[model samples]
Structure formats: structure tokens, C-alpha cells
Target: MYGVQINDDGTIEQMNDELAQACVNGLKNLEIHNYPQPINMEVSLLSIFCGFYGTSNETISAEGIGNIRKFNKLSANADKNYGQASSNGERKPNPWILTKILRYHNKDHYEQIIKPLLKKNYEGKKKEKQIQINQTLILNKIDLTDDFTQLDMQEKAANGEYEKEEQIVMDLTRILIYYEGETEDIYAIKGYDAICDTQVLYHKLEGTVYKQLEKININFKNKKIDEKDNSKPITVKHIFKKYASKFFKKRCKFISEDPKILTVFQGYKYKKLHTIDYECLQMYFYLIKETIAAGDERVYEYILNWIAWLIQNPGKNRELQQYYKVDKVQVKIDSLM
Candidate 1:
């Protein structure tokens, strides 16, 4: 499924053109159903998988796919072994080692080449390594979790979960700071469980969309609290501000300022942020805000939580459409070929 060639020497080859073209064709054909018009777009499986997994790493290039193919069997075995090890709280066959093997594609040399090298590097310096990690988290204002205290962070980092959490924390901090002008205490809102509460709130509000509820009021102060300390409550109102019209416009302007960022959004058309797109997105913010401002507490909570979740986890947009059983925004092309 990973699109790449595995060489006999355990080197990974870039994706072949024919397969890429075929996959693009498939997605482009689906444009009539729910994709945007002018269905000419390049789709990257590596990008898709990374997004699906909530990974921020763009380093999973086509070559990485080949690297993964080499020891698909070994990875499965490692995963099974890792599961058992984790349940028993033993740290044998660290997932990071498996990850290194996959990325470098050196199954044969892992014992002779990789293990010994890593052992030499990390054997006597465990506490020092952990201290550095703890210091980095402190600098970022991310809470030092039990995972960080233990070896769980390193293990989860191998699979990108820990990295994903850090990015999410950073994004949340930025959102809070953008609205409140400082992340004085928001740094306490760290880790997956904390973020998952917002994710779950998103799903709950999504379900309420089908129901015609004109009432919505949300006491944000009560629902979400800093997991690290129940004493410090995170101001969830700042999260709602993230989806405010001003924020969307500012974000659009900021994103448009960078050529590379624009390229990612504009795609084949190479167009700048169009007035229509901006207005539509702004209108979405307005409608959502109006609903929450006028509706019941539960509705406000769900919408705000969903908005917060979207800010950090953007890959779920496609899945959101599926959950709602609807196509993405359908704009009239107003042209006939």
C-alpha cells in the first residue's frame, strides 16, 4: 500500500510515476462527487497518511515508503512485541529502535550497526538525556507528564505521537496567546488526554448539528480544566476566539503572506486567497459564533470544542464531511466545457 520500490540492497526508491498518475486519476474522478471543481490535482499518499495519523512530519517522503516496505514483517513482529512489553511495563525492544530500522532500512545491520552505536551513545547517559528532554518541555511550557518522566515519551516519539502532542500544545498555546496576548498559564494544557477531551466535545456537538436546537449556552470554565493541576483552569473562551471572524481573516492574511504556504492551499490554480473563499470561511465563523452566542450551554461547548479540535487537528476535515454525510463546500463553477 505504501507507494515505493524496495531495492535488494534495502534502499528505498521514489514513487514510480505511473502509480502516482493512477492514484491522482482516481481522486480526480471523484471530484464530480465531492471534490472541488477542475479536478486536476496531485495527491500524495505519504502526505495523506501523515495527515491521517496527525503527524507533522513531511519527512515521510516517497523514499520513506520504500524504507517501510523492507521490513513490513519485522515491524508487525515489533509491534506485537512492543504491545506485550508495554503492558508489562518493560522497556525491551524500544519502538524507537524499530523506527530507526524502518527509516534507515538496515534490518541486517540493526544488531551489528545500529544497536551497538545507540547503546554506546545512550547507555551511560540516560538521566542526562531525560534531563534535557524535561528542560526542553519546560522551555516550551509543556507540562512534564508521567510519560516524559518515564521512557514513554521516547517510545511514543518513535511513532510520532509525542511529537504530535508537542505540536498540538504549541498550536493551542499560540491560539490562546493570540487572543489573550499571553500564554501565562495555558501551558498546563498539555498531552493527548487533555486534547482528546476537546476532540470528544467536537464529536458531541457534531451530533447536535442534525437536531434543531435554538438554545445553546456553554460554561467553558467548568468543562475543561488543566489536567496537570485542577487548581489552574484553562480559559476555554480563548479557544472560541480562535474561530472568530477576525482570527480567520488574520490567519488567512498570515498564511497568504508566505509563498510556500500559499502554494499548499492554492494548488494547481496558483491563485491567491480569493474574496469568495475568505468571505465563505468568515461566514462559517460568523454562523458558528452566532449559534454558540445565542444557543444553549451544551451547544456552545460542542461548537467551541470542535473548533478547538479543528485548530490543532486539521486532517479530520474530510472525515467531518463523511460524518455529516455531505460533500465539501459546493461552489458553482458557472462554466461549461
Candidate 2:
């Protein structure tokens, strides 16, 4: 399972369950439903509270009910990046991306509960916002949060590596970073996908990838993935389908694999992925560059199918086969489905 991490001065920490429970009453008081229900709920709210790179000083999110607010009206750069570092100075750890769980982010949960909880706790506590967040209830948010883990296990009744892997299967672009703390490091904690091409990267895990995990020695509490929320399996595939449908202004009945994309990636090898005619690149860029329209007729269909193929075969390079942690991701994806 993937636990929510709080990087305090470069040291990693997980969300405190006691703190989450402590705020249950506060969230309920605000008429917020499903507070602290999801696995990453705490972190998700906290990340949103950090503000969107100080982009707007607005109090709330549009189109949602709870209206998740910006606790700090005048947010600084410090307010952004959550606990992530400032720049790429040296090699540091980066977390893997997970399938976003925005199931409960609508009005009642996000706005009423999460937004108010953060604003209420963070007003006078900016000086020790991290402390307030770590110790107090407030909230935790985890937008595109990257991480590293030395996860390996083949036991029953308990699992972590597999949960992280399953997230990558759905998430696709996420990759593992090898860091040796005081010496070696890898940057790009947030938005690692932005730096890479399409996902369809890993269909297998690297054997010594565990060696890299051993190097970083990521030590965080155990947090399992929430397979089913309200009897429905939580999924990001549906989320992607939703956006793709809206983007092309058509119903994405079912996304299928695009053989052309994979045929081009056969035997391709690289540590870092580079864009080469859909050979390797990100779906965001792939779709945006062409900017297909509903009126594009069958072109719209082809674009959606291509995205579906990317989801199935996302790989950065030969390194991705080793980096995507296929074993870890596959187990989780299998269990969830």
C-alpha cells in the first residue's frame, strides 16, 4: 500500500491516523461528508490548501460544493510545492505517481469539509504550517505527489509494494527514482510525467530495482490503497476516459490499444524518454499538440484509441521496463479489478 508522505526537512513521514480522526468532529461541524474517508484524503486536502503556486488568492474552487479554499490569502512560493524541495541541486528522492482519487472531491466533501478545515487551522499558523499540518488535523493534499520506495514483498494479509505498483499501472507515467541519500539523487518530485513522453512505459519490473530502493531506504508508515470506495472500485482510468471524452466532445465508449504506437516502441531503449513521433512522449502533449476536435470525424476516434494504447503500453525507455515496477503494479491492478 502507498502511504501519504510528509517530507519534513528531507525526512519522509506519513499522515497520522490519530490526527485524521481528531479532525472528524471539526469536519462534521462544517457539514462536510466523507471526511477522512479515502486513503489519500488527508494528503489531498493538505496539498490543495498549499495553494496553486500562489496563482490566485481566491477563497474557493469553482464548480465544487465545499469550495476548497486558500487558507492564506497572500500565499508565497513557500506555500507552494508542499514539502517538496526548491530546485534540482543534488540527487534526492522522488515519489511515484498514483491514480488520482477525486471521487469525494465534490462540494460536500472537498469544499465544506477540506477547504474549511485547512483555512481554519492555517490562518495564524503559517509560521509552523508544517507543524500544524503534521500535528494538527487541518488537511493533506497530494496532487501529482512523487515518491520513492524500497517496496518488495510476496506475503499475504499485508502488502505495500503491490499497492504502489497498481497505482503506476493506472497512472502510467510514474517511475521510480534511485537515490543514495548523502550521495546519489534524482530530481523531478512533482509532475515527473510532464518531463516524460507517453506512459505505456513499463510492462515489467527491473530485477535489481530493489537494489535502488535499498539505496534510498524510504521509510514511511504502511498505507494500503482503497480498492473500493462505496462498493465501487476506485479508478483513474475512468477519470482519463472522462477527460478524453470531454476533450473530443464525444463518448469514449471504450478505449482500445493502438498497435501503431507500440510497434514503434519495440526494443527501444533509453534511460530518459524523448518525444519522437509518438515513439515516446506524454499523452498530455500528444493530444494537445494535435488538438483534435469532434468535427475531426474519425480522427477523434483515432486519438482516443491512441490514448488507450498509451495507457496500456506506457514506457519511457528500456529503463521503464525496470522502473515501472510491473510486479508491484500488476498485483494491485489485478486485485482492484
Find the candidate with the highest lDDT and give its number.
1
- The residue-level lDDT of candidate 2 at 259 comes to 20
For model 2, how does the per-residue alpha-carbon lDDT over 117-153 read when each residue is reduced to its tens digit? 4444434343365343334432211122233211222
lDDT of 1 by residue, 162-269 (tens): 222233333333222111213221111123335222211111122132131112222232222332243342222332332222211112122244421211121122
Model 2: C-alpha RMSD to truth? 27.5
Q: Could you give me the TM-score of model 2 versus the true structure?
A: 0.17
Clashes of each: 9, 35
Query: lDDT of each prediction vs. the true structure?
Result: 0.30, 0.29
Off by over 4 Å in 2: 1-5, 8-114, 117-160, 163-167, 170-221, 224-233, 236-337
Best candidate, TM-score? 2
How close to the true structure is residue 24 of candidate 1, measured as C-alpha lDDT?
A: 22
